[model samples]
Target: MLSIERTLLRLVMAALLIGAVSVSGTVYFATLEEFNEALDAELKHVATSLARYRDLSDASSAQRPAGTGRVAEPELEDSEIETFTRDAAGKLLYASDEKVRMPFIDSEGLTRVSVGGESWIVYTARHRVGYAQAAQRVDSRRAIARESATRILPPMLLLAMGIGGLLIYGLRLGLRPLDAAARDVAGRSARSLAPIDCTRLPAEITPMVQAINGLMARLDDSMTAQRRFLADAAHELRSPITALRLQLQLLDRSSDGAANAAARADLQQGVDRAQRLVEQLLQVARTEPEAQIAPMLPLDLGSIVREVVEAASAKAEAWQLDLGATLAEEVPVLGDRSQLLILLNNLVENALRHTPSGGVIDVGAEMRDGRPVLFVLDTGPGIPKAERERVFDRFYRGGQPARSGRAALGSGLGLAIVKAIAGQHGAVVELLDRVGEPGLEVRVSFPRR
Candidate 1:
């Protein structure tokens, strides 16, 4: 749950700390090694000088017991350096300081020895008379190493701290665009579904921003469609409900049997119109773009058209219209059967209602350009080219009057439902004037399998 800037800062600080520790450890060990080597060299040089003094005939005087024939301590820069000489009989002869006494060591070269319960690095050299030794305290060597580390560590720590601060500041500055994007989203109203700005965005975050923008665009479209459907439903339902109410009022006031019967019939007709309008409104809502379409399977377009024609036969007989279908082969297509049936029914019903008595309504399916094409050709007053587009809109009736005076039979949602269903199947629906005729040809061309 850590913020990006804090996470980056933590990683940078941890790296800096590790680097500081590594550098400090390297410097500490190197300084310690060099200091020890220099100390050992000084001890050896002093021991050699003292041995040479004894070889120059001072041995007889230097071989005496402790506190006798004392030699002046070497004029070394470090006062911690102590010098002494011992005889072959394991007794100290020459002493640079009277209080400094060390165990007699006959071995040569550098070695650690304890004097008065303190550790020192002693270097011994044998002469013709006795042994000469030079020693330095272990504690003094440790103190020098400590001073060296102190001198090197403070600057390293300060540099690491400064780098860490700068890294944190840089991380914060780099993430400012994300912070601004979040604030922009937070400040928007609930109704605001506009896409977020992607300009100046970092490449790493651009994909996320684009996805968010795409989701917002889809949401905006869905909400707009919902609002439009609701408004249209309310507007279309108002007229039938008002007419039904008036018819009911008239029936209630009528006392004559004939007048009561006529009012009752009028009321029934109004109720039927309202019920049909409600059904069509439900259909329109069901076909909204956001609604999930049923899965499509391979279906015979010709068979579907024939079935629709058979189903509408009774209505066609009542209207005295010839409703028949022609199949150019099986004419296979990929579609949802139930939805396709609804589509055909709506087309045929629209054609039958618009066509005059004795007019022919032919439903046909055939292959065109390696795809299935279904057409409903009606011998009726076809929709003009200008009004064809508007006819497919929800509850939109044509401006031209119906030849059969049966416009009221339709709720004006037939073509809208057709268009929606066609869209779901990825089909193209077009209304065109029938060739060499005054009728219309409505075609639904589906994609090639």
Candidate 2:
């Protein structure tokens, strides 16, 4: 994995190094040019001094008059600067070295030439009678330039090193909050899901921190609900299992045929009830918000209602109630097929269990106000408006027995499971009174796509 810290440090270091090298190189070249100019000026001064006399000897040893306070002109040294003079017609009149004479340039300021296998700086000038020239060794002038330019390095190097050290330290200090956030996350256990401290955190990191906090908050809620569901499920299962065991014992101990037949019948009923409860519990778990479910697909609400009513027709008949469906022509919505089916089944099953024999039950799908709605209505005394919301709570058996005898899931898991499934599908479940009838209408409204 690529690390943010190392990449930042390397980029900054590279920029500093480049900047330092650029400054040092510019100073070196600028100093060298100035030094060369000073040396060339000195050469011009010497060449003009030679133009005053015909040859080098009188110009050097000639003394100023005895009473004059001024000193005699200084003699030119041949090793440092060679002097020469020529007439206008190119006849050599005075030569510092007679054997190796340098030819003059057509126009003069400064020029380099070869003399006796060494490079020389030769300056030439026009004189009243003839032109004079002076020369100096090129190697000598460059030696001075090199020494002066090199002095710039030590201070520049020290400054670069100091700046580099400061950069590394500043980077470490500036990035400390990100490291602290990582450690905070690493140190947390399942129970400790508090948000990370955002004080003094950089703006670039804020969005990522907020996202993590949101996920942890959701996880905390899921874990809490799961713990509660497990506790309630365990409590609900214990009574039925205990009753089944006692019924089995009663069947084993009964001596008369009539008593034995009654015990068997009661035991069968208890087993069937336990099976339904386990089924409902599984449905609730599958509909949990954290579940990894199949993607929801576009489906027809009418088609789903028809399927559920058809499947429950036999169950409804056995309970001595009328079961029917009324569906719109095109009630399309987005939903997970299996979960929506589970939602409808729970509502219908509870209705069948609670409604008196000969009562009416209707399932239907239709569009109202631009949303798909499914409804299950029973012609039995409906849940009071006050207790409608409470029925969605897990294992919420009513304070009094329902219309028929008791709730199918004790009317507990059935409605709770229905609510959980509807929430996952972004649907809402409502309990309303049937118009003019002493019954309940359980309506599930699905959002438009």
Candidate 3:
């Protein structure tokens, strides 16, 4: 591909060359026409002046007689000009050059004739006594026109060269910003997604720069989210793996059957915890902002709430907690059923894990102000207002200790997944202290259709 500067220079030079040629050709033809006209007029005037001397036959060759209708001949400094006179019988009377003789023709204003192997233009004027003719060589007339046309060449060439130089310089100057931008991008490390500076960019290139910057910003955000996810996964996986290792060691050391069985149970619990952690991590990944969510369909929020409550009731009973649901009409919302199921499961599981035994955990849905709102209310010790926002961060357990006091077996990704899924459905999730109660209420509000 050609460089922009070279291409622009080529185009400009071509235009200038064409223009110069056109102007030169036009001027050459126009000058030739005007020169021919002037030559013809001079020839006619000379012939007319000579014809005024009607009695040329009576005059001596030395001088014209006084008052004999004689006209003083103009001195011919140019050797190319020749004049001659002829009588009625076509006999030559006098000639400007002794060797020069005018060509004979029946009648003529101007005519071309061959004289001594050279082309000449002659003009003839008839008088009462004789005819006079004035002639000039065609070669001399052509030389004058050629000289006038050649004079235009030097200035035109200089002008074209000067303009070409200016054009090249202007192109380089105009493209400097783009060159700077390319260099800036090339010099960056692969990890760098920083925006290219547009402070001094030209207006024509500003949109392209802005588009590049926008892509850089999105890539930076995606990379950041990926890094955070990996770190959180590593941190969250370490504890359960360590616990599983310890349980295996205990099982190996146990000699008695009771001790072996206890170790086996502990091992199974550790495995289960690790498995749950892995599942939550996967859920968090699936719900990432960059991930494509499952397609949405119109779903009944109330039915979804009831289904979650029914599924978790057995687990709630095992923990001696009351799991129930309140359906305040068939709350309709548009969402991916499986993702909403995951969202609801996380909310209820979080409530069950945090709430103490015999605590009441209620899942419900309702339509409020033309929008569907789903909520989970737990009778557990609520999170502090200061820690509410941080709880939505991946692997971030709130500052408040778990109500059960035994090490909580919950992965901290629950609320993060909840938040992500809510956002995917164009819903807002908020954690607040249950009104007039010492518990937490998590609410998801969906946009109205």
Candidate 4:
């Protein structure tokens, strides 16, 4: 239930903080390593200078052994003398300051030395009077670098906080459109299905807005269809229901045998009509989006077609219309059995209702293009090319044929229910030509999964 902006801002801030912490840790470590290398190189250079001086001084003293006592040589600079010393076998000799300890490595025999604090290398060699050594303090540099790096983090953290706050603020502003869109959706009614505007939205949310808008459009169509069906259903049932009540009253009040019989017959007809209308209404309601579907089972399309043909046979006989199934072998399909039956019954009933007396109605189901195709074809006045699409719309009946004989008794929801059923099953239903005659052919194709 969090607002879009707050949620987005919080997420972004968390990510930034994590990244900053990680980068800071990496930089601190890398800086420590670089400082250690630089310090080691500097220490080695200073040590090398001292070693060269020691070699020169020692050589001079050796060449003038007699003059060493007679002629006094100027004292060498403190920087050019050894702070510590080792013998020929590399044992510790002496120290100048407490800070000057034995070289990290043994300072005798080998040309290079390595050794402590974290280990460092020292270089040493033989001279005429004494041996000289060059030492490298790699660990001292590492310690200083680590300390400086640790010290730098607090300021970096403050800067990152400021930058992160600014970025989160900008992100919230950039995402304002999504917030507005969410509010727009929240404020809408259960019946409202209008599309949201996306022209002024940010690019990041444009596609989401567009998708919602498209869904809204479809919902609008569905709602419109539902409302229309309800209105038409009410209209269709009202008259018959009223007639049935009036006929029942007359039958109850009647004294004569002939009058009572007539009233009873009228009441029965009205009741039948009302019942049919109610059943059709229920079917239409099942097509609504909120309607739940039962689990699908393997049902044969041919069996459904045959059952519909058989159920319509009596009505077909009354109209003097021939109704029979021309199905091949069982055409297996995965669907809800009762729903499929209702679909086929509606289609076949619709065909028989429209076809003229002596007209032949062919109900068939077969496999075509690796899909199950169920069709109902009848020889009657066919729908025009312009009105074929309109006929599938709920409560839409063509001008010429809708009011013909008992066809006028229909609730006009039959074709719409058929279309809905086909759509639910991921099938396609289309009206086509009945061979060479002037009649309608309704073909429903259900693709294999």
Highest-scoring model, lDDT: 1
Please state the error at residue 278 of candidate 3 in Å. 0.9
The alpha-carbon deviation from the true structure for residue 46 of candidate 1, after best TM-score superposition, in angstroms, is 25
**What is the lDDT, from 0 to 100, of the residue 204 in candidate 2?**
77
C-alpha RMSD in Å of predicted model 4 compared with the true structure: 5.3
Total clashing pairs for each candidate: 0, 0, 0, 1
Off by over 4 Å in 1: 1-167, 194-214, 254-258
Give the local distance difference test score of model 2.
0.78
> Between which residue pairs do clashes occur in model 4?
113-122
Model 2: what TM-score?
Answer: 0.70
What are the candidates' C-alpha RMSDs? 7.6, 7.0, 8.5, 5.3
Flag regions of model 2 displaced more than 4 Å: 1-4, 22-160, 171-218, 406-411
Every candidate's lDDT: 0.85, 0.78, 0.84, 0.72
- lDDT for 4 in candidate 3 is 76
Which residue pairs in candidate 3 collide? Answer: none
Clashing pairs in 2: none
Instruction: Report how far off residue 297 is in candidate 2 (Å).
Output: 1.1
Give model 4's clash tally.
1
RMSD of 3: 8.5
Worst 10 residues of 2 by lDDT: 64-73
TM-score of every model?
Answer: 0.64, 0.70, 0.63, 0.79
